[model samples]
Target: MDHTTAETQLLDAADTLFYERGIQAVGMDAIRAASGVSLKRTYQLFPSKEHLVEAVLRRRDLAIRAELEAYTSARTTPTERILAVFDYLYEWFRQPDYRGCAFINSFVELGAGSENVAEIVRTHKRAFADHIAALVAAADLPPARVGQLLILANGAMVTAAIAGSPEPAREAREAAQRLLDEGVPD
Candidate 1:
């Protein structure tokens, strides 16, 4: 396979395996097997497993940003756009393969030991928060609404994953609506 094809396969395989199984539990051999890329070529493409993990996360970060934009941009009102983020989360949680946020999962599993992984997770999270802040601003909501909505969205992710139900998204949406109506207090 060409270099680009091989690299894409490797990233796709690693992302799947890492998300399905924890990062430490998966081996380079599994990525090689899943990607059908020779082990040597895999190593050549990604000098270390850490390199591959970083690449996979970076790609996922871009994907998630694009997806969030797609979800939020489709709504008419700024408030509706903000609420659509929860709608997106609801659909994401409904996926059969849904696990918790990949960034959070990676942070919990590898953040402490691997600064690279931790930084990647932190960057993704910061970008997500920035996105939320922009949405709150557009809605003419208080700056405090950013933190409130972030908590609701993130809490819903953990809650939905543990409870194995998408109901948390719905609950979060209701709570978000209340916050929008009631406004954040100082």
Candidate 2:
């Protein structure tokens, strides 16, 4: 395979395995096997498992941010844009392979020891919160209100993942609406 093809295959395989199984639990050999890329090539591209993990996370982060921008941009109002995030979450939670936020899961599993992994997770979350903040900008909401909305969105992902239901997304949307209506506390 060419360099780009090999890299893409490795990432696709690694992303699936890392998300489905914990990062530590998945070996380079598994990624090689799944990707059908030679072990030597995998190492050549990633250098180490940690490097590969970081690459996978960075790729996911960009993709998610783009998707959220696309989803929210289509809406006409600030409130609709904010609520569209939960709608996105609801759809995500209902996917058959849904396993909560990949960054959250990665943070839980690898953030303690791996600074690279932790930083990637942090960057993903900060970018997401910023996206929400941009969506609610026209509403004149406080920055803390953006934080609250982020909490609701992340909480919905965790709650839905644990409960095996998408109800939390809707509940979170309602709670976010209440917060938007009531205004943030000083």
| Top lDDT prediction, candidate number | 1
lDDT by residue for model 1 (1-186), tens: 999999999999999999999899999999999999999999999999889989999999999999999889999999998899999999999999888899899899889988999999999989999999999999888998998999999999999988999989999999999999976566
Candidate achieving the largest TM-score? 1
| Candidate 1: count of backbone clashes, pairs at least 3 residues apart or interchain | 0
Off by over 4 Å in 2: 183-186
Residue 5, model 2: Cα distance from true site in angstroms = 0.2
Per-residue C-alpha lDDT of model 2 across residues 1-186, encoded as one tens digit per residue: 899999999999999999898788999999999999999999999999999999999999999999989998899888888889999999989998888889999999989999999999999999998888887777777777887898899999999989999999999999988988886566
Clashes of each: 0, 0
- Which pairs in model 1 have colliding backbones? none
Shift in Å, residue 163, candidate 1: 1.2
Q: Stretches of candidate 1 above 4 Å error?
A: 184-186
